[model samples]
Structures are given as C-alpha cells and as structure tokens.
Target: MKRTSLIIVSVLVLLSIALTACQPASTKVRVATDATFPPFETVDEATKELTGFDVELMNALAAKAGIEIEWVNIGFDPMLAGLSQCQYDVAIAAITITEDRKKDMLFSEPYINAGQIISVQKSNTEITGPESLAGKKVGAQLGTTGAIEAQKIEGVELKTYDSYDLAFLDLANGQIDAVIADYPTALGFIGQNSEKLTTVGEVFTDESYGIAVCNKNADLLKKINDGLAAIKADGTVQKLEMKWLAGQ
Candidate 1:
C-alpha cells in the first residue's frame, strides 16, 4: 500500500509540472499615454474618450501582436518616468526617440517621423522662427522636445505649460510671442484656430517617434516592433496619416 501511494504521488507531481509548462504566458499589457496632443493623441471632448492617430495605431498593433491592452491616460512627464521605472508595460504618444531617453527606457523601431516647428499669432511678422524668438517669450509643453528646443534659443524667455493648448492660448492672448511644438501637432492647433495661429519658418529638428517600453519588458518591445513592421508594410500607417494628418 505504501509503495502504491508513493507512485501515485510521483505521477501527480509530474502531471502538474507538465501542465504548468504548457500554459501560455499572459499577454495583457498596461499601456500608458498622455492624451493631450492632437492628431497623435487626444481626448474627445464630447465623448470623453481617447482618440487620435496614436490611439488607433496602438489598437491596430495590439491586435496584430495578439496582446490585450488596458489604456492609462497620464501626464506625459509622469508617463515617461513610469516607463523608465518599469511601472507600465508600454507607452505610446508622439514620443520622440533620443539617446538621452534611451538610457532610461527601451524604444521600438521608429514608427513616425516628426519635427519641432514654431507657431505664432497669424498677424505676427516679427517672429519668424527659433532664431527670431531671441529676447521674446516662447511657450512649450513641459518635458517635451519642443521645450528643449525652446531652451536652446539664446535670450529667449521660455515658459513651459502642461499642454500645447495652453501655450497656444497664451500665444493668442499676446501673453507669449510664440510656441514651439511638433509640426503635425502645431498644424492641428493652427487648423482649429486658423484666424489666430499659424506656423512660421519650417520644421527645425528631424525627429523619429517610437513606442516606449519598460527597460525590463523586452518581449513587449519585440511584439511592438513586429506589429509596427507589419502595419508599415501593409499601408496601415499611410492610411492613418491620411485620416488624421492630411487635412491638418
């Protein structure tokens, strides 16, 4: 009887090990985003739902990668910090890839090409671009590449805001001379306030936007890159550009 019991116990242990080994890893990911930038990511005022190019693109990629996602809308700076600390699985905004940032977090392959541009009041002629912003008040969203560029302008008074909308508002109200922001994002703002705002000069810095992943989440990065490659090859990215950026 003792020998028979030992054999049964050994069989159950082996079976348990096999079952555990056969189980698939969890693919549900927590995706963080800052939903304030338009054309890239924004919240719909009427529905209070997140919408924009990044949102749609992320959904497509998640579906292609066979992963489930839960959206977490957070401040852009906080999102970056959280990603570096491995607090979130992934983050997708119009986040420009940089070597300095690369030290903290992992990034997917370049998904979109973006650049910083200068936006000023439509009637303003004195301020032409970053060069002309010298000795002038310039506004940008806090913790963005735009703000970094603004800070580079010698003699320029740099003011950082929580969102581009507020910076543009300050520009419209004559509180600030100009705003530095991503070209497509600036276009979205200018399109809505055509009478009040317009971009000057040209895109200043060449930038590539990438999906941010936590340093510890290498598998997630691979999934994102695979999905991104598929979408780019299938014309999905071009379709999104037309849908959101062409008119703006």
Candidate 2:
C-alpha cells in the first residue's frame, strides 16, 4: 500500500515538471505584414524568399528583443483583423499611424515618416495636384490612408486595388488617371517604370509609419520599442533606410 502511494506521488511530480518544461520560456512574438509592398516587404520573384526593409528590420528587432518571431503574411486588410484576434504580437508593415487605427490597436513610436503622393503616366500632363484631380479617376490600395484621402477629394472617382502593383497597373494601362500612395512606394514604383510614370507636383499629407501591437499586449510593446531604440542607436535603422529608401 505504501509503495502504491509513493508511485502515485512520484508520477504527479513528473507530470508537473513536464508541464512546466513545456511552457514557453519567453513570449512568442508573431508579426503580421503584407508582403506585397516593395522596398518595405516583398517576395523575390526568382528566389521566392521574402526580402525588403520591413523584413530586415523585423528580423533584427526579434534578435535584439531576444524573442522568436513567426511572420504571418496576409493581405493588408486582413492584418488588422488578425491583430484584433490576438494572432500576432506586433505588426510592422509600413502601416501608417492614423487616429482611426489607434482606437483599436496600440501603436509604437514612429519608425518612418512618410508622405502621400500622386503618380501618373509620364505622358499625361493634365493632372498636377490634388485640386487638379477633380473629375479624374484616382487609384489607391484598398484600406490604405491613401485610399481614404483620395475618396475625400470632390469630383474625383476613387478606385481601390488589392495591392500597389495592381493600382500601378491600372494607371499604366490608362484605366486610372493617377495612383495615390506613400512617397517611398511611389518612388520605388516610378523608378521601376520611369518611362511610364511620374510623380505629380509634390507629396500631399505628412504621415508616419509605426509598429503596431495589440492593445492588451503592453509587455510586447515595450520590448518592441526597446528593440527599435537599440537598433536606431546602433545605426541598423539608418543602414536599412539608406540601403532600401535612400538608395532608390
């Protein structure tokens, strides 16, 4: 009878240790991003490997924070939904920090300052600025600040595309008069198609991109902010900016 009691207690202790060992050492940080934005996040055509500024930055930040990162690549619109469901610990997809988004998600310090700009076919000379866009068909990525801004302009018909590439394609095919997007994306797109597209006038709105975390995950936010600061101080941020943004 004593032997049986001793065996049961020993089994219980082993089970407890096993359960404790299975618990994660540190919080697993899942990051969600739309990988279609080039110079920020994109998959290489030939190699099929994800590469760009956001990808590099996130990898570095994970190392700095001593956290393991599982990257979830979904469309831009679904990313917010995933974040809300607690699917990801953070999101860094060149997402603009806007007042509307703040109501649902927590935003980290601004990592990059960006501006909205209009890009048009090089041969089209009529459209020059926001005011000149009246009665024209303007294209922007769906669920983006650029889309919201474009829809606000009177007399301009706003068209939404799932990705910047599709928007640029519409502009290139003369299906849309202009494509409104962040300056970095516009610049990269224009560089790739210099003979086809040109930036009209100047950037319109001043905006900043930030890393997003769920409202309930304050601990994760702190780790990300600390990692960002460390990367900035160590010049990793500058190196990435120069390599991806300035180099273009």
Candidate 3:
C-alpha cells in the first residue's frame, strides 16, 4: 500500500512539471514611461510607485500575453529615443501617435483617442481658443505634440517644460498665458485643482495614444496588439476607462 501511494504521488508531481513546461515561458518586457502625466501614468504620492491608466493597462496586457515587465520611469524625450535605441522594449506613456513617430518606431493599436486642448487660469477671460494663443506665452511639455503645435501658433512664445507639473506651476504663478495639452490629461490635472485652472477651447486636434515599439521588433508588437485586442473584447479596456475617465 505504501509503495503504491509513493508511485501515485510521483506520477502527479511529474505530470505537474510536464504541464508547467508545456506552458509558454514568461517573456520579460521592459517598458519606459514618463510618470508625470496623470491619469495616464504617474508616480503615486504615498507609495512612490508608478500607477495610473497606462501603467495598469500595460500591466494587464503583459499578464495576458505571458510577459513579465520592468517599468522604467524617465523623461519623455529620452523615453522615445531609448525605445528607438533599443534601451527598452516598449514605450507606454500617453505617447501621441503621429506620422513623425511612425517614421522612427511602430505604434501599437491606439489604445485611446484624445485631442489637444487649452488650459488657462480659471479667472482668465482673454483666451477663448487656439487662435487666442497667438501673441501670448504658452506652455507644453517638451517633445510632445502639444509643444510642436504651440510652436506653429503665430507669434506665440512657447515655454517648454520637462514635466507638466512644472508647467502647471508656472501657469499658477502667471508665468505663461496658457497651456496646451491633451484633453483627458488636462482634465485629470485640473480635477482636484479646479479653483486654479480650467480647460478652454474645443479639442484642437485629433490625436491617439499608443504603445511604442521599436520598428524592428515586429514580433513584440504583435504580442501587444493581440493582448490589447483580447482586453478590449473582454471589456477590460472599458472598465479601465470608466475608472480613470469617469467625469472626463
């Protein structure tokens, strides 16, 4: 009886090991982001860990695709450069999908469609739209589509900041006339600071946020896209959107 029990246990253990071996190994994927962008990705004040929509979504996608991830928080400009230079496997900030970026790297299916908007002091009445940005000082994060759009505003003095937190600081201090940023991001930033800031003007341009992969890494891109599709179909994306963008 004891010998039979031992043989049965041994068979079970071997079967467990075989099943585990049959499953795909977890792929370690390194993801880069600028955590200053709230709602999309931010460093939680108390925990000091990256947490937000993009962070959560990236984690979900990685788990679904049997991938382990290392999150790297860095400056927005360098994040893109690093992705292209192969320093990271993915860039998952609220990076806008643009023709210019497509030239350098492949973008995953757009996870969110957002638009550029203007933010101004709550008391300000002078600026009404993008046209009003002309001849005024405006701020945007460096290397963002918003910053690029600001540069084309005739006679506008564009102030570039590494992070939007500093841009909002300058805005509060009346350093810049207004700030141009993504609609959802501006909404998130002003949600708790409504007394100080407000969004103005219609969405200035149609934009989409996507995960950036090295153009050369098609296999990795496919994994991300497949995972994203699964999540979207299973309502994961909708749940996240509702949680993060409820009032916006």
Q: Of the candidates shown, which would achieve the greatest TM-score relative to the real structure? A: 1
Per-residue error (Å), model 2, residue 181: 0.4
Q: What are the root-mean-square deviations of the candidates from the true structure over C-alphas?
A: 2.9, 3.3, 4.1
Could you tell me the C-alpha RMSD of candidate 2 in Å? 3.3
Whole-model Cα lDDT of every candidate shown, in order: 0.91, 0.89, 0.91
Candidate 3: regions farther than 4 A off: 1-24
Clashes of each: 0, 0, 0
Off by over 4 Å in 1: 1-21
Error of 2 at 72 (Å): 1.0
Q: Tens-digit lDDT track for model 3 on 1-248?
A: 99999999999999999999999876898899999988888989899999999999999988888779999999999999988888899999899999989988999999999999999998899999988888899999999988999998898999999998898888888999899998888888888678899988799898999999988899999999999998998999999999998785
Error of 3 at 90 (Å): 0.2
Instruction: State the TM-score for model 3.
Output: 0.90
lDDT of 2 by residue, 1-248 (tens): 99999999999999999999998797677789998888899988999878899999988987898878888888998898778667777887889999989888999889899999999999999999999999999999988989999988999999998889899988988999999999998888777788899998888999999999998988888988898899999999999999999845
By descending lDDT, how would the candidates be arranged?
1, 3, 2
All candidates' TM-scores?
A: 0.91, 0.90, 0.90
TM-score of decoy 2 = 0.90
Which of candidates 1 and 3 reaches a greater TM-score?
A: 1
Clashing residue pairs for model 2: none
